[model samples]
Target: MLNNVAVAAVNGVTPFELGIFCEVFGIDRSAVGLPVYDFAVCAAEEGPLVVGDGHFGLTLPFGPERLEEADLICLPADRGAPTREYPQPLLAALHRAVDRGARVLSVCSGAFMLGAAGLLDGRRCTTHWMHAPALLRRYPRALVDPDVLYVDEGQIITAAGTASGIDACLHVVRQEQGAEVANTIARRMVVPPHRDGGQAQYIRRPLPRTACDTMGEVIAWMARHLAEEITVEQLAERAHMSARTFARRFLAETGTTPYQWLLRQRVLLAQELLESSDETVDAIAGRCGFGNAAALRHHFLRTLGTTPNAFRRTFRGPQAA
Candidate 1:
């Protein structure tokens, strides 16, 4: 039912983020049996607008009035969104759009605009990690999760930096339409249909060194033998330490218990098999050391908040399933 879309073009808007909205919603893809949105780019004030890159400008076809009728309102990143104040009328327009049941999405630093409008108050949201501290400092009530690619809070969605906008947009499409439509759109765009990992997995942080080199060696062995049932005592024996000592050091080094870490890695392996291979659920569960499909389902849902079948359908599409 989400057909009409509009992007709010603020001055100093990042061209790539603005272009993401146009590429995803503005194009007419009806020939491929995809839903074609009535998309438009609208500005806060009429006339020529300067882009963020400082070397170029753009002219929007419509004004804020276009946002009034849109089912989805997209706010791409603007260079000035961090410190510059938004126009009162523009903020009111965004509030009005959401008040009447329209959804709003912010890409990267565009989350700053939503925070300024007070839309992110008491809501779980995220911006680019570099700006997350600033966002939290600016809006103390906003629960800013910096480790996610995007946070979906029903009517409002906020994404991390740059390319994460595509993931957020596709999430909306999958929710409104279905995995098939979302996958088809992703195929046309030549991006992954669905990314299984969160931004935390991609964060480049140096691991803390342990007192001994035993933890790393044990971890490497665990990864290689994920299909076998692993025990803390067994791992402790392999690492030449007591079980209690191993458990304490493992938590200190990895921030999680040995059992929890092993379970999570097994679930991650199951996800890869479900997405990239034509394996049966029972077979995958066994390979991942879950013993059966029920066990896999239990762990998968606990870890990822979704079932294996749903995850597979999301990545492989309807016919591929």
Candidate 2:
């Protein structure tokens, strides 16, 4: 049902994020039996729009009126500072699109434009974890969850960082066309159909440089031994520190306890295995150090709010089940 699509082009838009919108919706895949959207990049102002470097620019054929025909509108991240104001015409078109029941999606800091449009007010949304604080300060009425890769608030979808834009697009495809279509598109892109966890697990929240001499080395060792059951006492021995000091330093450096970090790593590994391999739940559970299917299920549900098998089905299809 989501056939028409439009990407709002603003000055200072990041070329890569804008290309994500073009890649997902602008391309014609109808020969392979995929939906072909009526897509265009629309500019708020009429004339040559300057981009990143002032020397280079784009000339969009359509204007903000094009957004009226779109079933979905994509806002790619702009390099303009988060505090900069978007064109009022572009924001008004966005408001009209949503008022007519169309969906709007933002990639990374594009959430700033949505916030400017007042679309994110009182809604759960997200942007890149690095910019989440600024977004929260700018739009206090908006509920920002920096942990997740993306947040789907019915008509509005806000995604984190560059690649999560693909994930968010594929999610909309899966919702509209089903898992099979989404999987096929992902295959064409050579990216995972789905990924687990939030940007929390991916953000490089490393220990302080001073502390990394000891804690960092242990963290690297822990990553290598994710499949093995690790105890903080054993880790303390390995670090040549007492249990209390090890625990204290672990929290200070990693911002999480040893057990919590290990559990998150295990869950992340399980997710990768579930998406990439046809292995049974028990096999994956053991491989990820969960020991059994039930344990994997418990942790998967706890972390992702879904069972492993269900997650697999959502990504790999029912036949995989």
> TM-score for every candidate vs. truth?
0.66, 0.68
* Candidate 2 residue 82 C-alpha distance from true site, Å: 0.4
**lDDT (Cα, 0-100) at 166 in candidate 1:** 96
lDDT of 1 by residue, 1-321 (tens): 799999998889899999899988999999999999999999875558889867898887899888899999999999986788887777898899899999999999999989999999999999888889899999899999987789999899999998899999999999999999999999999998777645543344332345667598888888889999889999999989999999998998888899988887888788788888998999999999999999999888766656788777777886545
Supply every candidate's count of residue pairs whose N, Cα or C atoms clash at under 3 angstroms: 0, 0
Best by TM-score: 2
Candidate 2: 10-residue stretch with minimal lDDT: 201-210
lDDT (10s digit) by residue, model 2, range 214-307: 7877888888888898999999999999999999988888788899898988888887888889899999999989999999999887777677
